[model samples]
Structures are given as structure tokens and as C-alpha cells.
Target: MEFSLILKKINNTLSAEKELIFNDWYSQSETHRQYFKGVLEQFENNRITVDNKKGWERIDQEIRKKNSTKSYWKYAVAAAIVIAVFSLPFTFKNTPSDLPPTTTLEQQATIEIGSDKATLTLEDGSSVVLQKGEHYEAGHIKSNGEQLLYDSTKTTPNVDIAYNILTIPRGGQFFISLSDGTNVWLNSDSKLRYPVAFAENQTRMVELVYGEAYFEVSPSTKHNGSHFTVTTLNQEIDVIGTEFNIKAYKEDPIISTTLVEGKVVVKSSQTFKKLIPGQQSKLDSKTNSIEISKVDVSNEVSWKNGFFSFKNKQLEEIILVLSRWYDVDFKVQNTEAVKIPFNGVFNKKQEIENILKIIENTNEVKFEIKGKTILVE
Candidate 1:
């Protein structure tokens, strides 16, 4: 198969006959399979924008210069795949030499990456601080360090509903398994209010007071057709055995509900919309409007996967996300710095300094850490 045709096949743009031919070619040699794997990795890591002709020309020149005397067709093919897949043209200017030396001054102490921490408010208004790596049992609810789970062994009849709130502070995350077996993953600076034991034959309801959460609803069949509902500030999501993510931070202008699987109905006071898999319903808080759009479900739920996936996100927006995860304050010295757009994925487990370094390496802005505050310029 021609190298270009292989690229087309890799991209799923080839006919069935060509795909079969490409698969046969790949199976003939381990070198072909390895080359294909490398190409796939490059395509995932870098966003290639150059035209096909230019990409091939650049690859041909590089191969000729590096392996002129070799008769290695595999080497040539690998080189072409790498060049075609990973050629990102970065034009950002380097960091200015005249800028002040970056320093890490003491603000308080360096805040660590967010861990499993939360405050569980009981039905009596008293609270329990859930520490990392510690297990506790409160009534029918049991917590195993990272997650709070309701014991299924205990059964509750029709009774007055009692609610408890799990509040995750800045630089903290937590998980909870409701009495109905539904699971919720709460992000930093968030709160989930749910019943300790849901009443029999009643709707399983929870409220995301603020921030973000990813929910995996238990099948209604298991609960005698009891529906699941998530209440946010401006919208309500009705689910039936669905997995979805909701971002309704009070600081954000919109409440976004992205469905991963099954179905969800997003309802505001004015209107309602149903969402299928890979679709998102965004409710505008200001206008009280609901809009539906197709989205990359994985990107929307990347926080639950321990990464920050930014797609053309503004510097200020990125700062807000980082601030919550790192428990730091941000002060942008240059006004234009907040307007700068960034697009990339970064590990959420990294230290605040290391994460800032990745942004600084772009050379669009620099960062200085003063205690717990990050000054961006």
C-alpha cells in the first residue's frame, strides 16, 4: 500500500478493500505494525495542520538527509508517518530574557495536589471531616477512605427523607455511592446533598450545590423503576440508568450537562431538552435558555479521569480550574494574559509549580509563585 493510502486507512477514510489490503500489509511485518502504532501516538499527541503535500515533502527531505545511504523502506515509511502526524508549527515567542527571575516566595505553604477529602454534614446539622486514607461508618453509610458508600444490607421502608451533604473543599475530591447504588464523583469546591437511605418507591434525587460532578445512575429496574434526578442551581437532570457529567459551578455562567451513555433530560424553568450519548445540554443562567450540542464526552469528563483537557480555553478559565485543584489564588498582572488561549492536556496529579511551568513554557505568559498565590504576567 502507498504511504498516503496507509494514512487514509489509519484515519478510517479508506474503502473496505483498501482497509483489508492495509491490514494484510500491516500483518506481513512487525515493522509495519510498529510504524502504525507510532503514527497513531503522534496523531494523538500533536494536532497536525499542514497540508498533505507539504507534510510528505518535509518527511522526504528529512529522510534523505538522515538516511541517504540506507535502502530501508520501513525507515522511510516511519519517518513519513512521524512527520505527517507530529508536525505542529509552534510560532510563539520565547520567554523574554529581561523579565524578573521567577521566585517561589512563602505565601502560606505550598498547597499539595487535591486528594480525597470532604466534610459530611449529618441529618442533625453536625459534620464529620473525612480524611484521606481513613474509613468511617455513620449509621447505614460506610466510608472507605476514598468513597462513601451506603450499606445495601440495611433496608429502609417508607419513611421521612433525611439528607446529608458532602462538601469537598478547594484542592479536594471525593466519591459517594448512594443508597440506591448510584455513584457520584465530586470535583473540587463542590457539594452533593443526598439522602442517607432513599425511601421505598420514591424518586432517587440529589442536589449538586455547586462545582462539578460525574454521575453513574443505578438502573431503575433495580429500584422498582425509581427515577434519578440531579438538581443544580439553574437546571435539573432526569436520568434513568445513565452516566453523565454536570458542571454547574456558581462562578461559571452556564450549567453544562454532558451525557456519556443512556439518556438524560435537562430541564430549566423555561424549557427542557433531552440528550443522547455524546450530546451536551448547556443552560445559560443569565438568559434562562437551554441549548444542545454534540460534544467530546471524554473531554467533558476528563476531570474524573485525573486530567485537565483544555480546548481553546482562556488563560483566566485555566487559572480558575488550576486554582481549585491546587488551592491557590491567581493574580494576572498583565490584562492581556487572561485573554490568551491555551489548548492541551495536563496531569492533575502534578505539583502546582510543575503545572505552571508547562503553561510558562508556551512563552505567552510567565508565572511566579508567592506562597499559595500564583502571579501570571
Candidate 2:
């Protein structure tokens, strides 16, 4: 079997027949087992000592070099091992056992992680705090702790359109179901201004004042073909029926809209772009321009599914996300540390210190938690 096939087996991407061939090849000779072990050892050593980008460059050079005879297979195996190890760091994987314990940090600090908490601003300007796991009812809207649901059965005659705002604070999240059956999940530090009940014979409109939100818009067919529009600071997303996510934080440098299903039209002051499923449109604040790209919809909507998924993201970008979710502040003492790239999948319910410790295990940097502030060095 070719070393490429064996490498595919190692990454668990091989067909069953290829896997059997690899197993038979491994058992054919003790030399093959030793070679595999040596390759793994070399990969581990390089993972710790070498820069990731430089390692890939070396692998590229090896691929360009021509080799004849059986020795070529050995080089191919080595190159494959290096490629696997480096690429693993850019993809989400299950947390391995035998990682460092989180007891010390948990015992020393008194920090509260963000949860399902939000403030609801009623149409009359009265604000109510929605605590975690607490049920609340006001007008036709009902909250069963986890999400707010509207009872469309208790509709009143249209007088004037009444607006309500759902504000999720730092370290908090929330969910709401509108009377029109549209569902929204608000991320930390997000504010959504929407009507208490959409008016009849009018276009449904809402404003995402700031931060991130995932929307599962109800079909217009159910509402007499009415259109739903979400207006952000930089652009507007018009939907007939679609599931999408928008990140428009006031402090962010770009406003991003990612479509998961169906279709939508994203309009800015200068131009309008139409998005299909699995596409994302980003509005750059500096240039006032819109750019579109294909994206992994699962990664973009992972937060709403109770996981933190990162792909080739910088340490500083990850830290900013953690700050909002943990309601903490970060102070980086080393400027270079912020530029380091990371990729991982973490449970949202994991302890803040435990997550930081996992990053520390990379040995590229360290973190010091002082109260609610994380000092990165």
C-alpha cells in the first residue's frame, strides 16, 4: 500500500478496504511498525519546537523534491505525518484525556460564567430582568427560562406598532420567539429591537442594534407573503424565509452575515448582494465595502448549538469572544502572543479557567487570571 493510503488510515479518512490493506502492511514487518513509531515521534517533537507555518513550508519543499525507489515511500510517510499534525491544529477535535486539571484555578477564584440572562424592554419603556431558569410572562410573550415564546392566539387589534428590545449583557445569552413564529438566539452583549407583534398588511422589520444574533425566520407563506427585514448598523438583510446568523458588534471592525438555509438579500448603502445557502457577506467598516465568500455554516452557527468552534482564528480574536461569554476583561502583556493562531472545539459550559488552561498547554503562551481580568503573557 502507498504511504498516502496509510496516512489516510491514520487520519480515519480511508475506505474499509484501504484500512485493511494498511493493517496487513503494518503486520507484515516489524520494520514498518518501527518506522511508524519514529514518524510519530518526529511529528511530536516538531509540533513543540517548530513554527507551524515554517513546518508546512518544509513539507511543501519535500513534496517538490523527486525521489525514486522504496526510499520515496519513507519520505512520503514522514511528510504526511508532519502535514497531519500541523493541520490538526486548525480543525476542531474532541478534547483528549490526560490534560492538566482545572482545580487550582477554580478553587482560587470566584467568577461567574455567562448564562441565559437578558433584559427585556417593554413597549411602555419598563425594563425587566430575565434571570436564568426563571419563568416570566408579560402581555402575549411568555418566557420559560430558556426561551421567550409569544402566544399568537392572544392577539389584540392593531392600534399602533409597539416595539420591545431584548438586550443580552456580557456573559449572557437569550432566545425569543416572535408572534410571527420567527425564532432568534441572541449572543452576549447583543441588543435586538423588534415589534411586540408585527402589524397586519405591513413588512416585518427589526433592528439588530449591536452584537451577534442567529435567526430562524418563519416562512412568508405562513404570514401572507410578508417580508422580514433585519437592519444592522451597516447593512440590511431581507428575508422571505431563511435561517441565518449576523455578527454586527458595535466594537467590531466588520459586520458579517452568514446564511445557513434558504436565501436572502443583503443591502448596504452603496450596493446590494444576494446570498445563497452556505455563503457569507461581510461589510468592512474601514472601506465601506461588501465582500462575499463561502463559509462552513456549521462553524458559523456553532455557538447557538452550545459549542465554541474556531477555524484558523487568532488568539486575540478568541480572547475577545471568551471575554464576552465569560463577562471578563483581558489584558495582553505580550503583543506577539495575540497573533498566535488557534483552532479548537469547546463546550460553552466549560469553566473559563479550564479553557484558558487548555490554550496554555500549547506552550506558546500563558495566562494569569486576576479576579475577572485575564492577563495574557
Candidate 3:
């Protein structure tokens, strides 16, 4: 028997004695440590670890054929021991979907975005046809190829008076520039409202109606009340200068505020919380409560970088995010599957079917993709 098969058998064995011996040898050797490190490095860099392992095994077989006196069982046992030890922790890390049977339910819902085209609604309730262009300014606003820009000069009464609504369709995205020079990257199915210019004495405030957005707040050396504020649903975030991401979809139960830089004070009608970098503030709608916890910043902010990151996120949470990004509906046939958490990452631009295929590879879950609907079982 080969080392891999022997190790797999030992892992599945009900007898504790064999498992203990295998685990001990696995953890006690430096040779095993080097092998495991090599495997991990190959996997992390998107190299083929399984192929490399097979290549090593082929070399071992060739060497053994030349020296019949050498025993391959000896190396197999050594490798088996290490594999047994490392797999113990991993075997216990299965998601809820890997568990026993449970009741199932079917859900049907639709996702809607505020608008489809990239348009600007002026302060006078009129509209401006802003097409894809380079460096164009109307009043105190400007836009590049991908985003709109806002640049305003403070004056005695702040004569510049302009406000507009930027709407992104379900499958559309846009960029915007705030009067304070803050840059915003709005995801699909998102809407943002901002003034054309900052008020002379008022603070800068923007409202997010739905979906996700990343903000890089520009510093303000002038304007005593130069703070940046973002309002979503019933919660408000105040920041002096910071980089942050907010997911405040109306349909989702929890509103998330993940701080990337500086500080933000998230205030509700009756509660408030301060968050630092790498911290995520979660607000629950049902109870009107807020909770803060340290999170993996890269995992939370990866979407802004055009990556989908799932750090053991519940299947329900993953569905919510997908629903927003893909502008689709989720239909789960098994309620028990909601408890399952997935840990994975892929480019945001990848096809939804590709992402679902990766999830199905786990073997504990299956998916049915039909048009804009995803059915998980």
C-alpha cells in the first residue's frame, strides 16, 4: 500500500492506538515538517501540489527499483504518520452542511436596483446627460472615465449649490467624487446622494440608499466642521478622514461597517460605537443594536479590490452578498444548509457559475443555476 492510502486508512480508522502512533511520528519529525511546508507553499502560490507529490513518489519508486534492498514501507509509514497528525484538526473543521440530515425549505425573492443607467439628477429635479467622458465638470462636479469628481472652493456663503443622485443598476457600477475630494467606488445595485458642493458651515454628508461602497475620505485642512458622514438606513457614520467600506443593503438584516483606516463612529438612533482599523461594526435592524468585533480586514475589504473573499462565512451571508453583486435571487431547499460556512476566495469578475462550481467541489453541497436564480441543496 502507498503512503497516501495508508495515511487515509489510518485517518478513517476507529482504533485509537494506530491513530496515536501515526500522529506522533507525523508531528515529531523535521522531514515531515519540510514536506508539509512545501505542500502549503505550492498550494498558496497556485502551483500543483498533488502533481508535485506524485512526481516525488515517482522518483522514490525509481530509486527503490534500483536498490531493492531499501524498504519503501519505511518511508510510507513515516509519511503516513505525518498525514495522520495534520488531518486530525482538518477533519473536525467541517461545515454544517457536512452534518446529518435536516428539514428543508424553499424560498423565492427578487433583488431590485434603484436604476439601470448612470445618470445624474440635478438639484432642480431636472436631469443632465452625463455620458462616458474624460475630465468634464458641471457646476462644482467633475468626472473621469470611471467616476464623477467633486471639487469645491469654500466661500463666504458657499454660492456653489448643487446636489445630485447617482444611481447604479443591478448589474452596473460607477465611481463618484465628493465635493471634499473624497473618492467613492459604488458597486452594482447601489445609490448615493451627495451635494454638488460642501456648505460653508455645514459638515460633508452623503447618503447611501442600498448596496456596497468603498470610500477614501480626503483630508480637509479647512472648514471647522469638515467631518465626513455617511448615512444608511437608520445608522450614520462620522469620520474625519478615513478609508472604509459599508454594506448597508436594505434587504439584509445586518448593516456592516468595516473600517480600513482612521476612525469611524457609528451612531444609531439610540446607540453609538467607535471602530478602529481592522474592526467591523455590525448593526442589527430587528433590535436596533450594534456590535463590534475584530475581523480579517483583507477578507472584508477584498470586494473593493475586485475579489470575493469568504472566511468561513455562513452560507446565508454568502448568498446575501452574491444576491447583491450578481443581482440575483437565492433559493435554498434545505434550511440546515444555512448554517454552513464557506472559506474561499475568487475574482469578483468571475462567472457566478464558476464560483458555484467551486463551492460544489466540497461535495457537501450542490447548486442549481437557472438564469438569475441559484438553488442550493
Candidate 4:
């Protein structure tokens, strides 16, 4: 019933408690629904034709709520922005998850935001810790804290190509610019093995040893028509020049490859399917079968933009993602609770406790924190 809650719901930032409150108010009566409809219509039109100027003022105040992210004012120039809180799709107007909820460790057992950090294993088997605000250089490869950049301008004279492995720890993330100018964004608990300098006039290859990564591959035309291929356990993605995301986490049963731009062919032992933009190919590792489906590309790649976007995701699956991001463990005391579907969006800048508290307010479940482990019931 509160206008503030409605606004939060509109932006997909509704707290769990306020979500229930808004859902109740939304479903309570047709008049309430009409008022909500009128609010959105006003947002679309940028004016209020109705005489309820006082109510409209209250709505305006909610839109200007301090620290707001996706206020109606953001979509002032455009209309048709609707909140997909329950069934409608909340359009980003633009614009995944390790289940990252950034927080400080001062008062609790210590949880910090997954930062720009990774362990780089050089060709000599030596290792270097790459984190924000640090620098490292080897041969033609260099890292400037936030990203690892390879100098393609230099030529590799080594008879054997030198490979570098990057491993991202939990509560961390990193980016890499491959020797061929292919860009990769690695998620937490992910590893990528690539060459320091891609060989010329040959197929460019890399392995997603594990975890998730988003790739903006450099065009083959830049490399004299060298096709790029990404290899996983039982899958291979072939692309000439395309942008895509691959999720091959060991904990997850399915290996998902979501094509954002360009084209990719996802091949398994069973069959191969070519993916177009906005399409996702999910391979069942156990069955070795792949299923292609249309997906919301924004939801699949939202983590690249620093937000956790869930579209009717089960709590159990969501918990797994969060555990990896926060470097914590979670146990659900109530089996039934694991299947509960939830919808909302969260920024990684929030504290884990705050996020847990927000979800706890839903009353469908409660949380017990023991050290860094979370028990849900």
C-alpha cells in the first residue's frame, strides 16, 4: 500500500518484506490495481491528468528516494517501462550472479566484496597474485591491477607457445585482454588457460578450465581469418568473432553458453547447435545432450554490469551462486524452501547480512548465521 514500496517494486529493488506488502496491496482490489496502473501511465506520459495531485506528489517523492537506482525519472523520456515483479517483465530501459552481495567484515565473521583479483600462473609454473591497484609484467603480457592486458604488437619467438592460467578465487572477479585483442571477463571460482601470444595464421584456442566467463572475442579478420575456439569438458564453442558468455561451473549440472552478439556453434558429442544473438544453449553434462532456448540475455549477463538479476530463479540455485561470490556456505534446513521461486534484483554493493535480512523479511523462511555459513529454514 505504501508508495515507496511500489516504487521499489517498480525498480526491481523491492525488499522481501516490501515485496509481500506490495503483492498484497496489488492483489487486494481492482481500485488499488487501477491506481497502480495510473501511476505507471503517469510515468509513461510524464504528467498527471487526474485531479489527485496530492497522491501524485507522494509518487514523485518515492521516485526521488535517496540512493535510488532505477527510479521512474530514469525513464522519463520513454514510456512502456513496467515492473516485472510478479509476471510483467521489468525492462532494464537499456541494461547474473555469483550471488554477490558486497559487504565489510568488521562486525561479522568477515565478508568482503569479490574484488578484481586472480592468481596468474605463468608458463614456467610460477604464480603471481593479481589484484586491484597492482601491476605485473611478463614477456608481452601485463596486468594493471583491474585487468590483464596482453600486448599483441609484440611477436612471440618461442618455439613452444607460452600459456598463462588465471584462476579467480571466491569473492573475486577479473578481466583479461587476450593476445589477439579478445576480451574476457572471468567470474569468481573460474579459471581460464590461454596463450600469452596467439600464434599467427592458426586457430585461436582457449580453455575455460572451470567457472564462468564472458567473452568479447576479437574478429578473425584481425588475425588473418583465424577462427577462435573455446573448449570445455564436453563442449566446444567455435566463433570467428563474437560476444558470448559461458557458464561451466563444476557445481552446476548444465553448461550454458549464451550468445550476445555475432554467432557461435556449440558442439557436443551428441550434436551441435549454432546460436544466434539472445539465444542460449544449455548442455546437460550428464546426458551429454544440449537444449537450445530463447533467454533474456540481460538476465544472463547482468553480472558483467554489477547487478544480480533473478527471473523466477529457485532459491536453491540462487543460494549456490551467492555462496561462490561471498566465499561462504549455505544450508537449507527446510527442504521445501529450496524450491521456492523468487524474483528480484540486487546490486553487489550491498552487504550479505542486509541481503539476507531483506530475504528473511518475506516470512516464508528465516536464516541462521553460524560463522560464515548460512542456514535457511
Tens digits of lDDT, candidate 2, 26-53: 8964335644554444444334312434
Clashing pairs in 4: 84-88, 96-303, 98-321, 114-171
lDDT tens string, model 3, 1-377? 12333334433753566556556655863333333343343234332122324433553675467653223333322332222223323343444454323233233333333222366687888755444554456666666646776664633246675668987766566777676678888877778888877777777888998878888887655557578899998899998888888988767889999987788899998799999887999999778799999987766766655556665677788877777777888799978766766555555554565455445533446777665687887
For each candidate, what is the lDDT? 0.74, 0.74, 0.64, 0.74
Candidate 1 lDDT by residue in tens digits, 233-319: 888888888888899998899999988778788999999999988788889999889999987665677688666766557879989
Error of 4 at 179 (Å): 0.6
Count of clashes, each model = 1, 1, 4, 4
Model 3: how far residue 9 lies from native, Å: 39
Q: Which stretches of candidate 2 lie over 4 Å from their true place?
A: 1-107, 154-159
Candidate 1: lDDT of 205? 82
Q: What is the TM-score of each candidate against the true structure?
A: 0.74, 0.73, 0.66, 0.73
Model 4: per-residue lDDT, tens digit, 310-354? 656777887887887888899889988778776555556556775
Off by over 4 Å in 4: 1-109, 155-159
Best by TM-score: 1
Candidate 4 accuracy as lDDT = 0.74
TM-score of 3: 0.66
